[model samples]
Target chain A: MHTSGSRIVRVGTSLAVPVRRRALVQGLAVVAALVAVGIATLTLGGLGIAPERLPAALIDIPGGSEGFVLKRLRGPRFVVAVATGAALGISGALFQTVTRNPLGSPDVIGLTAGAGAGAAAASLLLPGAVSVPAGAMLGAAGATVVVFVSTGRGFSSPSRLIIAGIGVSAMAVAFTQYVVMLQSRDQAAVLHAYLTGSLSARSWQNAAVIGGALAVLLPAAIALGRRLHLIEMGDELADALGGKAEQTRVWSIVVAIALSAAAVSVAGPIAFVSLTAPQITKRLSRTPGANVVLSALTGAFILAAADLCAQQVPVVEDLPVGVLTAGIGGLYLGYLLVREWKKGTV
Target chain B: MLVGSVLLLGAAVLAGLALGSNPIPLPEVIAALSGGGDAYTRTVVESRIPRTLQGLLVGACLALSGVLVQGITRNPLGDPGLLGVNIGASASVVTATAFFGLGGHATIWAALPGAFLAVGVVSLIGSGRGGATPVRLVLAGAVVSAVLSAYIQAMTLSLPDVFGSYRYWVVGSLAGGDTDTLLGVLPFAVAGLVLAVLMAAPLNALALGDTTAATLGANTTAIRIGGMLSATLLCAAATASAGPIAFIGLAVPHIVRALVGNDHRWQVPLGLVLGPVLLLTADVLGRVIARPQEIMVGVVTAFVGAPALLLAVRRMRAGT
Candidate 1:
């Protein structure tokens, strides 16, 4: 039978769950868009390959230029883009659900900037090549500790956390700029692109890194989603219901930090994807609570489409995907702010 | 308090003159100022004058803009740098430099309109159904700043020539200051300062909430417009002349407000004095701290101001 908001789905006698019909449709649509974008990414670039030859490219990975471009280049870049986007999306959903605030994403809370700063220090300052991902993870964890400690009341106070995050973000950005200034002009240009979160020249290694992170973290995020939703209701209710809000919040934050750090390490700190994805997905799905699956799909679609658009922009070669997302996502944030104000929700 | 700030200003000006990569002695600095030192020593000291003067003018403008913006918005977090004015100015300057080949003194012309447009956008988004809240305005400003910076990066990265000039400017330093640039931006800074002084009482009146201020015979609309206009002019001049220095505007008014009550008269003057004191001191430190290589004033201010910002955030009440 139909319920007010969600329909109860029955599978045999053991398990039944209520699912929102619109969320299911939107989720499928996002996945379809993602597939189309993936196909387009594979077909179009500096050197174009026809859509019909994509299957051939995959088969002849050791032989033709088309295969080299596809298997070695576009394929890995596309995979990293989707994986990191998905990672950012689920990370954002977890943070938003845990904080019970739409603005509570990795970027907003200084984690992304911290990761950027850490990566910058590793790349620019370390004598030889250092592990950029490890640096990013440490930076994200450091920001979390600072924000958590500075709040005094922990993450329960959303505004306080957000304010502390702004401070931390500012400091990290300054440090990043300082590091950038230390390099030669040519090196600085390259670092600048990387810092802005480019997907260009992404290797299979980068793809594997993000892919593995998503595989491990995404499932954990989804399983934790139910508890996070209950946590959003209130601490007392959640604890009374055996959800243990405090423990869930702490675990969710750790998972979120790892997901964002892995994405940042692979592609650098892409701006606003983590902030806008969950918000966009929630609005599209017309559902409450953390929809990690839907958000991840939306993020993958958004990043894939942005990277495709970035590649296609004429006269502006080597445009970073982060720049496009920053501009578009910022506009979205502005719109969200006005809408929330009008709705008296902010 | 005024006397104390003036004394601090004097000390900072001395530091600006005395400390540098060259490390002139205090006596040599005083002698160089009197035009009695050796030629090379005199040259170095003379070279420092433009930057010191630029620092004073830019710092005063930024601090005054901070007070006006905070007063008008009634938001403690209000600052020219935080509110996207500086980045907006950078965006316009970069666009002018890249597309129109405007360089040196001409970039100031591009900055004013951009700063004004940013102020307009921030107000439009920040103030609405229930008027502006501190968090809403800050978030709106951050969003605008991020977008503008993305545009700036896009322009800079695409053209190597633009990147060369932009990298230095974007770091927010007084290192590139010269007499011509100082002269170019001086009039706007003066105009803005005078306007800020003229708007003080009206701003104070409007602080009692718009309805109450309007009922008390204050022109809320005029006060609002005048305040933002003054802030925009000051911010543009400072950013155009010295690049986009952060924390001076945010920190100066805050420290000033803590010393003086909520009175705009006291805050405005003290901010004018303290702003330069902070900037010149930062410049001096940037010079001496790194030995042969110099850190930018922008980086130094961020280092100093970030902790202040965090402290402020920690001490913030439950809700504004």
Candidate 2:
């Protein structure tokens, strides 16, 4: 029952390897699960590629039927899913840690809605005035700023943040819908599809954009991982322990916003992956602190699995992945709210 | 204050009739109302009249329900739409159209049951053995709304025919309301309003806290159930009549509460009058802004209502 502080397994000190060993094993298991799901996503689609040839097909560079499916269709989609999921997972972990609330996620805080509004404005209002990703990033930043300023106490009060986020979210969504309605019918349909968060027709370009973002942001989040854990001990205590609490909070939020905006730009606002992933990972790892890596893995797994389900589910084929996540996540969110209410923390 | 609210409501109703894609003179509107106008004037006035009436009814219903819900939950932010009633009605209507093959007037039937079922589930989950607190009710409502919204998205995506009509309806407009529809929904709205008025006194008693209210001879549980039922009924009728117009239910009560003190007796009636005023004003504004192509009232209300919500949140935080 080592509940004195955040569970710390000091490497090279040789204090206890069991806790560290457990984390390592859990990480490996999650990785294995991710790989299995990724493989399933690749091979289980309409393309009837044999399982034995999957490894070879994945590696084959030139031009073959299997290579075309692996590289062209499934490969990019798989990469985008993993990248976006990991981004959301990491961002969710950072935000939850900062807000000290399990419900604190990018989507919950209106970042995704802001990104959607930005994308809508760029595509509809500006019309090639700027790139979609840049627009989304701007929107995400704007939403974060609004939430921050509106909260008055910054990240200290979780409930105030959520309420402010909800208000901002409503406004952003209204603006997006208004912009959508202003466009031509076909264009409006395109915007609507994007808003629903589909992986269909995703390109290697999308994959590269998200992958590039994760490349920079993931490492940055991991580096702040220790500070994030410390800050979870309360700001004064973390400051006493030599952690730059405010600096860490700001940096974590910036990284989280960047990751979220990048994902939204590529995949639209994929609902609840950022939210459910971290909580699931925390429960699975049974750890006292933010499990950034494990959360990323869980996010990747959930999004990939959800994408797979969206593609393959009978009668629900080609349904936007966001719908599935929102449907499942909504129920989970309700349950969490009830639990939190019972505990008198909500 | 009540007289002022009634006057505002009257002005809003007049504005709704007088302003549209095709504006009518006030005299012409009056003439049409008195059943003696030219054919073109009659056609235009007749078309606008039902929508205006529908707006008034729906707005009043939503506003009154908002007061009851806020009173029962004891949460200033409590709104029928926020409490999952709107989304539930929407999801039900969408499902009815998409799967059950029901359409047009038949959708209202679906909406009523759906709205009630959703509120029922929210109450059951939100209310533990003790009772549903404001926080739990809100969280429950949000969760239900999210799930139902997803269901709506899925249905609309799968069924394009449904989507074509559902999209406009979901955004909420008074354009679709005809005299027949208006007349049909009127009974339910009136019934719900009556129920709300009847419960207002008990609601005031309940505001003193459950133990005190009980000691004061108010049946707290009965009041809660009665209030919830009335609110749900009102929300369903309004949503069915004109889609899910956002913000009015949430915002109007706050406005009314601000103008009139927090007496349920005063708040309920004032909210009833002022709710239509806000809704009709937003609807008329929506018409004026977009011109030939009117924006839906729901969108307009969001634009108007969200700022009010932010203010409400700020005030709530400050008070606490």
Candidate 3:
């Protein structure tokens, strides 16, 4: 709960700047670190392109092996990872702030599980009838509606929302498994990769879909970020401050769902990125409220770095990036829980 | 209530044998049971006998462990699966297969040690300065489960050959196991059940909180350790025989508690019987729902168990 005091610079009647210099510097540093990791992800692989040539290789024509690897393989995968990570990061920040729960990510709240179930049903049950993304969206929306209606208290009570989410997640995962069981071996293999969130063989189209969704959703999230901070002061106070807490909450959730569904559809349901990204950003930036933009950058860095490790790690080459994130996230969650316990919160 | 549970269990077992991909007449099933039926009937009965036995042992062990866990932790949501025992066993088995090149049959042995290791870690981490609160225990278990499951996924995905077997084993079933596997794990299950029965009185005392239990002349730490050990043993044996089944442990105790108060004596026995009944019924339902294609019992239990979990949460919230 440490809050670095902000210096308020009063402009003319309508504008004001409340700046925290230290947090701003930290955020910039994180972004710079992310760029470094992005460069490493692009350059350090089996092909071993130098950092200097990676820029040209990415934009160059389709001729040599290096160009082929950059444009067709590594470039799209990296873009998809960045886009997916950003979407998950923003989504995590939105839900965590709106619910005022550190654990209130799409994965914890059952949205990812719902999206997985949707994708499974689409791919396994309906086959080619519906695209994976559409089915995922439908499923994510369905799960959100169910959770919203069933909890009755909305997102006010963190524990209740978490419990309901756990139940819903279990059922959704079971449904997905049942669908997988129903499919043939080959089809099940394909669905399995999607179920466990992978970036292997990702195309530019995959990157574009998530990128397009983020193009629309991230701006809305950023605009709502101030209101989200106000809502943290309780609904009554937020209302008195001219912030429509209810509307802001609902809009924040909608934006979160859109971002989460888009990310899941493109890269399946990557675990822990959404949950850890926002929390890490909040701590790193030393911000009083959810650091949405910084969280997006952190998430992009984490996922991209994890993807790089998954691909280039000697013993476990081409491992699904989700596995690495889930492993790391699980440890991070354990740490968070112990910290919460020591703080007497849990 | 005990009589009713026993009768329901009997009926469920009977239904499990009578209904399957190939249904047999009651007389023929009975004849097969009495060792007088034709080869076809005997074959069907024989295959089902092992599966039925597995279901009974696994279900009973899971339920007893669930009761013990809920009682000791004083957490309504406490279950062997939720506490990371099942995941630990699954992860151990996967690790054994991938690294040690162990055959599938030896997985149960690997599972026992792994389950204990996970349970120990969860208990240690969950216990804060004040003690392990319900929330801490559940959260610790969840975190541990997630970590282990990630490892499992990493291993399975890396080794496609392992994935082929791991997927089916992870889902948990009683179908593939034979009489020998059932016999092999029965001792551990029986020993665990006996230990659970022995600890029921201590558990009853422990439910009154550690201070009150100590005043009642109970060694709270000893009781807790014993309870945890027995629960871990039962869970490992069940998980080793049948992959990781969800909800039986979480839902059954609640259902049993609702039926016959929370006295460990009544709750323990009734849960033991009712556990198998619920599982067998779910297994039968799985078989019936998909005529030619069979759904795993684990999937059916999740569908049934999650609603029960939601209800439990509602009731807990309301009661509090």
Which candidate leads in lDDT?
Answer: 1
User: Candidate 1 on A1-346: residue-level lDDT in tens?
Assistant: 2557678889999878678888888988999999999888888766757888777666765457777777787889889999989999999998888766656888877888788787777777673567766676677778778888877666656666766776787778778888777778887887688778888889999998899999898889987887887776778998999988778877887788889888887888898888789878876666678898999998888788888888876755568999988887778778877887788764
Instruction: Determine the backbone clash count of candidate 3.
Output: 0
DockQ metric for all predictions: 0.38, 0.33, 0.34
Q: CA lDDT of each candidate?
A: 0.82, 0.80, 0.81
Range of the 10 consecutive residues with the lowest summed lDDT in candidate 3 chain A: A1-10
How good is the docking of model 3, by CAPRI class? acceptable
State the lDDT of candidate 3 residue by residue for A1-346, as single tens digits: 2245667767887877566777678778877887887788777866757877766665764467777777887888989998899999999998888766555788877898898899888997677899876787788888877776666666545556666776788788888877766677677777777778888899999988999998998889987887888878888999999989878877887788789988888888898888778877775565767677888887887788888888888966767888888787678767876776677653
DockQ of 1: 0.38
lDDT by residue (B6-121, candidate 1, tens digit) is 99999999889888888788898899899798998899889899999988998899889999988987765577766779888888988989999988778778887888788778
Better of 2 and 3 by TM-score: 2
C-alpha lDDT of residue A24 in model 1:
82
How many clashes (backbone N, Cα, C below 3 Å) per candidate? 0, 0, 0
> Candidate 1: deviation at residue A206, Å?
2.6
Model 1: CA > 4 A from native: A1-3, A8-18, A45-70, A94-104, A131-160, A219-249, A282-291, A331-346, B1-6, B22-47, B67-78, B121-143, B194-226, B252-270, B311-320
Q: Is candidate 1 or candidate 2 better by lDDT?
A: 1
The candidate 3 chain B region of ten consecutive residues with least summed lDDT is B311-320
Accuracy of chain B in candidate 3 (TM-score): 0.92
